[model samples]
Target: MSTPTTAPATDAASAETTAQAHGVELTEVAATKVRTLLEQEGRDDLRLRIAVQPGGCSGLIYQLYFDERELDGDAVRDFTGVEVVVDKMSAPYLDGATIDFADTIEKQGFTIDNPNAGSSCACGDSFS
Candidate 1:
């Protein structure tokens, strides 16, 4: 697994408080999709969480899911009643990034366009 770029946490408490602030953009298309999914699940308390994890062909991979619990150092924003959260460690990598959904005969899913990523792998699942 590729290590996070942030400094090592001295302790659990410190780790929880050490997240740097950053903004991640969620397009209307993406927010609508998230809201629809949450409605289908009958969950009004869940928020969409996006994170960068280690694994995949590239050093880092993207993790997206619905989370009801908000961890320490989590950054959150609301778009059209849809809440999106990003962990402290993953904030830097996703800053200024945009998430969009594409629905077509060939492609149907959420996609991330991160300006911070220098390059991505052939599978389009990981990035540096």
Candidate 2:
């Protein structure tokens, strides 16, 4: 049998446009929470960076952190005063995704509702 081939990578501009079309959104609640967290840390130069990484029980994991570095091909969106950044590779996977904050008795943290996820693990931490 012949070896399978993979598609070539997209250019930065095209990738960004595609990502925008996919609809990655940060909810007002999430933005407010992020802003509060930054204020508590006395930081104003950080942006919330979200990305998908390989690993976890489901083969893919979501990574969320505050980053000051601006890498090439990073897709950024500003919700009021808060900024959210997603790397190019993770952009496609995060399309039509929403980031929200939950502050109920049962759950209290940031949550990601990703439409691109085909399957996820029990804890809802990873997806494939």
lDDT of candidate 2 at residue 128, scale 0 to 100: 96
RMSD of 1: 9.9
Alpha-carbon RMSD of each model: 9.9, 9.3
lDDT of 2 by residue, 50-95 (tens): 9999999999999999999988778788789887888888988998
Candidate 1, residue 50: Cα displacement in angstroms equals 0.2
lDDT of each: 0.87, 0.88
Q: How many backbone clashes does candidate 2 have?
A: 0
lDDT (tens digit, per residue) of candidate 1 on 1-128:
99778755567556544433457999999998998898899989998999999988889999999999888789878788988899989999999999999999988999999999998998788999
Candidate 1 total steric clashes: 0
CA displacement after TM-score superposition, residue 64 of candidate 1 (Å): 0.5
Model 2 RMSD to the real structure? 9.3
Please list the residue runs of candidate 2 whose C-alpha ends up more than 4 Å from where it truly belongs after superposition. 1-22
Return the TM-score for each candidate structure.
0.82, 0.83
